[model samples]
Target: MIVTRFAPSPNGPLHLGHAYAAVVAHDLAYERGGAFRLRIEDIDGARSRPEFVEEFFQDLEWLGLSWDGEAAFQSHRLARYAGAGERLKAMGLLYPCRCTRAEIAAAATEIGPDGPIYPGTCRHRAVAPEGAAWRLDVTAAMNRTGPLEWLDEGAGPQAATPQIFGDVVLLRKDLPASYHLAATLDDAADGITLVTRGMDLFRSSHVHRLLQALLDLPVPVWHHHGLLVEPDGRKLAKRRGSPSLADRRRAGEGGLAIADALRAQRFPAGISLSQALNGTP
Candidate 1:
């Protein structure tokens, strides 16, 4: 059976972009007689709030979407993340890094998919500094895994090219796992067969594919759907202060109406769907 999930971080209330992504995942699974699941990505202890989590549940319920089981929380699976990191460390695929973001930015020469590609400053450090984050040795990992590929529902077969991101972080100094590690593990754990998310995250699938190869996790097909963007084409993000679903709900707007409009590709004025690849966006 196909399984899909809507994994959202509870750092803020759900926005229209999140609503669209959730609806896509929910519909894909339900229409095919599969299971839809929810996963709360609350691993960032400092930012994640219980009130926001409750609000997420309320928003999804208000949006007329339901999951098959109780939602999974990343906070409850810290040990599993730590264990995965340890396994990677044992394989000599992870290295500790102490470079701060500002330092990396100053030293970075080339830009990669997720911003400045991290320069391997601490890649060869013999001793790990205090509060060092763990980074995967992408070069060595690729050497071990050899050539890899993953399938996308829309793009079809894609050759995994994780090297583009340089050495990506697997475990953070402040958190047990980064999104790359936790999400890959959680998807496999939840038995997800299809990963439905926005196209903005399309490049992330390459890293996730490499992680699966290293961890021996089950591979799943991905669907990188169009992103909900502003009139200027900037993707709707909580950091930029996009309007939340809770706000609409509190205004006496009908949830089903909003969902139906979204399903029909009828977005609010100034909001449009962008299906183009990274460059065009």
Candidate 2:
């Protein structure tokens, strides 16, 4: 059985880009007689709001999409993430890092998908400081797992080269798990067979594939679809103050009509699609 999921963070409103992502995931599952699930990625305790989660439900409902069973919440799975981190630590693949963002920016020589690749300032520390972030030793991990590959429905086979990220964070100082650890674990836990998300996360999949290997989690095929962007080529994002689905609903626009238009690639004026795989907006 094919299992797909649309995991959305409840830190902001659902915009057209999110709607498109949901439509793709939902249709890929239902059209193929598979199960489509929804997961609330509310791990950001400071930003995640119950009202936003409620709005997510309302927006997806308005989009005429439904998921199988009750939604999963990342906030409820902190222990699982912590355990995964501990396992990696026990295997000597994780190290506590006390470097701040400013320190990394100052020392970083190469940039990666997520921004400045960590400089490994604390990778050789004899003792970890209090409340330090945990980073994966990507080099050591690759040595253990050797070469790996993952399939993408849109792009076909891809050689997993997670080294580009350079020892990504598995656990943050403020959170039990980073996005990489939490999302990868959640996908495996939910039995997601196909991961359908925007192309901006295409490279993130490389890191995710590595995590899957390290954690002994099931690997899922990925489909990184094109992103919905503005006239200036900027992808619709909550931080950019993009229009939300709620605004459209309040304007009395038909939800099904909006979804149908999106399915047909009939984007609103000034909104276009970008298929760039560089993770740029």
Worst 10 residues of 2 by lDDT: 272-281
Query: Weakest 10 consecutive residues, lDDT, candidate 1?
Result: 272-281
RMSD of each: 1.4, 1.4
User: What is the per-residue lDDT of model 1 for residues 68-157, given as tens digits with 9 covering 90 to 100?
Assistant: 989999989999999999999999999999898999999999999888999999888877789999999999999999999999999889
Residue 78 lDDT (model 1): 90
Model 1: residues with Cα > 4 Å off, grouped in runs: 277-281
Which parts of model 2 have CA positions greater than 4 angstroms off? none
lDDT of each: 0.92, 0.91
Error of 1 at 55 (Å): 1.3
